[model samples]
Target: MQFYCSKAAAEALETTQKGKVKSWLEAAPVPEAAGPWAWQVHAIKLARQNVFIVMERETRFAMVFWGIKKGDGETLLKQFYERMVNLLLCMNQDVNWLNAADADVAIEQILQRNKRYCFVAGVDRSVQTHINEVARFCEGEVHEIGSLLMDADEAAGFDEAMNDTLRSVRGGDYFYPNAVFFCSWARQYAGASDELCLELEARFQRVRHERMAMRVAKHSDSSIPVYEQIMAVLQGKGLKP
Candidate 1:
């Protein structure tokens, strides 16, 4: 994703050690030629595969940062700065009011987030299963939300649920409905009329729970199959396992 930050506004944010900023006001359009003064400030990455350009808005005389991601963050930022300086020098514009960009809270979050895949251990073998599982999860969430809209007793509750589901989907965070795992199997099964979709979701859930059970069993003593444990719980609840 490309993010834009104005030059004057960017300076107000605290800088971090992660990236450096530079000015590109006099950058050249080509290797030997320079670009307009409006195209001045640039934030370069020290690494490869990443680049950022900060352009000035002619009308407002404001600078904005535009970043490209494809390399390590540090390298990209450094290169971005170096390229801006070369471009400016070629264009014959004195570099002024240009410095490294500060790091911010959002940058910290980006660094702290879990970027590595949790299931990378068996990615080759489990890739297909993982894709199917994700599809089932998406379909199930949409189906569940649709059911809730159809069965809600209050108009307010239905509206709220619809809004919430839309927001979550737009934010790319939709997943399996957790309540279905604990609810009566019959109640959960009744939500979907499409037998195939329901079966796919259930199978996906079963395999997931089985994996979890195996992990748990590895550290403990449990002879029961994971499915059996789930079925027993359903039976005790007076629902078909």
Candidate 2:
């Protein structure tokens, strides 16, 4: 199935902060790195069901929604995109770079090749090593959902913590008081992914011994049992509480 944007959808898209996405992407000094609006999509089997994970790479915020009927991959993908775009619009974000893997036919429908492509934006809790890892939330895949949350209750808790985290993010907090929440969200949703890092997941190769080098290293110190360093980093820059 092809992805279509109706007139209403296009008109509605124009009304969003997604335009900031376009504006930001063009003005961004580092185009090669993931933009503030970049996102990643993955379809995985979990709880004996198909789950769609759409994650904003920079923000590291994710929304999990169920998508059944795995027979038509394209159809499922299209549905995922539709919901994701709606969610993005709600959050006042849009996509500049979208990363996925090994699905050429499904991926091509959304690429506009320097045109006004619409997408903008879109996890979690752990039961935490550090905010250091949540600080680097973009370096993993979403398909390892099974390994992270385990079951429905944990997943539900994930959504709750994530909703709270989103509230903090929307409040324009560079570093929130409850920074530990970010670590919990990251550990379950973004950490411990099976896929190799880098946005080019299509060419993502799992190198031997690559498993040892984790994207998120647990932080600790003799002074503190574990460092929730996000606030410390901000305080260093004179972010007054």
Candidate 3:
């Protein structure tokens, strides 16, 4: 989906308080290394400073939501929604066509009781670590997932925790894969055919590893734990020292 802010709105962004600008862009609490906003930066690279636009590839639609700076969170939120609604109207789309974060509870309660929209949340390491806290609220089938961006050690820890959580799940099937490696040898463990569950775990680990590598390469100067973890994964994967 694509959206563009009016020229006035784009200009307003520059005059918006630095704090407000940070919040609007969902910038971190502390400054991150350079180019962290590469995607967003690329979007606004040559645009008229007064226009804010978002384009979605799937729908080939551009949405223009106006940004306003205000000290009152409630008022700001109201205005934000109104701007979103106005944008939807201009595009000749229903207000329900928009996607936002975690407002599922309220939106589902009022607008689409039929549950037309399904939101799948991507759980990161921190959220995965507190599985119980998440599972308490996330009631549904869980596909055992992991990140491959971590080193074998970190991945191993994550694997164990995932298995534990899988065991404790209220209702659902657990699926994963088995390691074909036998220590330093290439022999598959005897009598241990890889389960679907084990395969899922391995898949998650690989994806996590790749994601970590990308992150590390993208922010080479950052000293964040994610960067360190990515480096560790690269070393473990024999892709780096």
Candidate 4:
């Protein structure tokens, strides 16, 4: 998530909005971190129905893109992701041209693009019997983008997501990776087939949506039941309602 800007970019940004531009640049993620990083991209409505979110899962840092037109699958994500990465490194309006980098796009070269940086294919979570969230821009094929972007564009939603991300990374949220939920489920289902394990994951997500509908007044990490469902399934018990 560390960023580096050219001397010119820094100089130009320093003057804009009395350093608001520079501060925003300093605060946003540049996406070059070596990562087992998680990402999710999907569309939402704003000034248009075409808004898309680009986010890093662990950091919960996000960017929103708008006025998109659907294109071929990989073409759509790569084009936008390339733009998103470049936008992060440069000023808001224009891309920086760095003679120092060996390639025309340093981060794209660094990330190795589809080989590692972006997901060209879709997982199409839309098929789940629960809710259908098609990445409408990806030609109805879907990838596992997030539920967060619907709310995260706002400061309150952004802070809440960032807080939950930090807490989850530190193992506070039971349903987060490496936390008690996943760890316990992994322990119980160590030898299970991949499909079976994925089913458990799906059920957890379903329960999460149901819980989110009943948003709590003192919101924090989702409570224990979401975690419990996975364990119950792995232990050969039926899923809980």
Candidate 5:
């Protein structure tokens, strides 16, 4: 139910025409006030463009729209309504006019004729399912690599304590431990040939460094220090940082 805007988003909201972005935030439904399937919106900005992320925690559902403009909140809201209608239709639920009659009528007419419908909730659920399956497989793979590392003569320095630390450390909170595990994993299990794994490791390092640079650039320009505050709130809620 808590709302937290990213630093870039906060800055954009502040600088945007008055009542533009504020109206969008006001229009977004609070989680506590919404239905089980309703979205909780989070604002963010990337490359000077506004973004609104909609999520439903119970279903692990999410949808994102970027590069939003002033006075476009209604457009996004209509889109969300359309998406939900399409989803309900897909599930063979009886179609009824949505509360936003004008918006729903137009969307309903469009959907009535269209045979193909892509629902955000459906897509998000599918993706999350796939991710969970892949994660389970990858965890097994990582465990194999870890075992190899522990048994190898060259891995003498990486003892049980070090391995425990690597596994337990929260990757989202600290970058260095993540980098360490990534490099080790890439080197040990990425490819059959040592040269291939080494090449993959180099590429990973380059990508990681570039992303870090970009993060620094984005966060440094914002005055509010929004990310830290948001993280603190999330941690307080017993969510991952």
Candidate 6:
């Protein structure tokens, strides 16, 4: 699927602090030489004084980095880049395995397989209008992913419950009642059955590999050990790694 940022987000990024602007200028020439998605950073330029634009050609996505002059643009770019990577990785399994040319072809195949389009928006009030307009233009559903956690007490309890369930299962203390309850819940939510769960379990490994590939691409030194161990396990299971 194509990715985009809200116009307001783009506008807000127009004039960042001086330090980041300077760094962008210095790094502009080698924009694709590094980063999480080295194949994606097509162009980085100072659109105007203190205003920088980052373009990702593969997805036709662009963002403006503006305001402030003190800190590096790492925080802003990291947040945006991670979200972009997540979307791309979720949409195409080959995102981590193939070369840029092959990866692009894989992404195209995925898009052809899934006809629906979706627009996701961050829950920032400043960009609501832009999000609405884009959603309208695409004639796609618009949704938010994270604001549900704003209910602090409910979120904390939910987290505790999930962790407790995982701990119990890991400790060989799986309770029949909880298992039945979760199975029923899954059936109601996604019509999951025993066979479907088994299928999903196998599919989970593939998804894990995709995520690991992203980590290896972005942080090879730290991610390689874990990746190697997981690959060995998958190989042991007679699965492709």
RMSD of each: 24.4, 19.6, 21.1, 17.5, 22.5, 18.8
Residue 223 miss distance in model 5 (angstroms): 61
Candidate 5 weakest lDDT stretch, 10 residues: 160-169
lDDT of each candidate versus the true structure? 0.31, 0.33, 0.29, 0.36, 0.38, 0.35
**Clashes per candidate (backbone, < 3 Å):** 32, 4, 35, 1, 0, 11
Candidate 2 scores a C-alpha RMSD against the true structure in Å of 19.6
Return the candidate ranking by lDDT, descending: 5, 4, 6, 2, 1, 3
Model 3 agreement with the true structure over 1-241: per-residue lDDT tens digits: 1112223223333434655542222223222222101111011211122212222221112222222232222333343334333332322121122234323332333233221211111222322323333232222212233211123334233332332222212233432111111110111111223464254345445654665577677867656666576767657745542
Every model's TM-score: 0.20, 0.28, 0.19, 0.29, 0.29, 0.23
lDDT of 2 at 164: 33
* Model 3 clashing-pair count: 35
Clash count, predicted structure 4: 1
Better of 3 and 4 by TM-score: 4
The TM-score obtained by model 1 is: 0.20
- Which of the predicted structures, 1 or 3, would earn the higher TM-score when compared with the native? 1
Give the winner by TM-score: 2 or 4: 4
Q: Give lDDT: candidate 1, residue 227.
A: 60
Q: What lDDT is obtained when candidate 1 is compared to the true structure?
A: 0.31
- Tens-digit per-residue lDDT, 1-241, candidate 1: 1222233223322243558643322221233222122222223232221123222212111111223433233443344334333332221111111122322232232223322211001111222223233334334544666421122133223222221221122235433332122121212222323554455446545654565467656755477765666666546745553
Q: Which residue pairs show backbone clashes in model 4?
A: 124-142
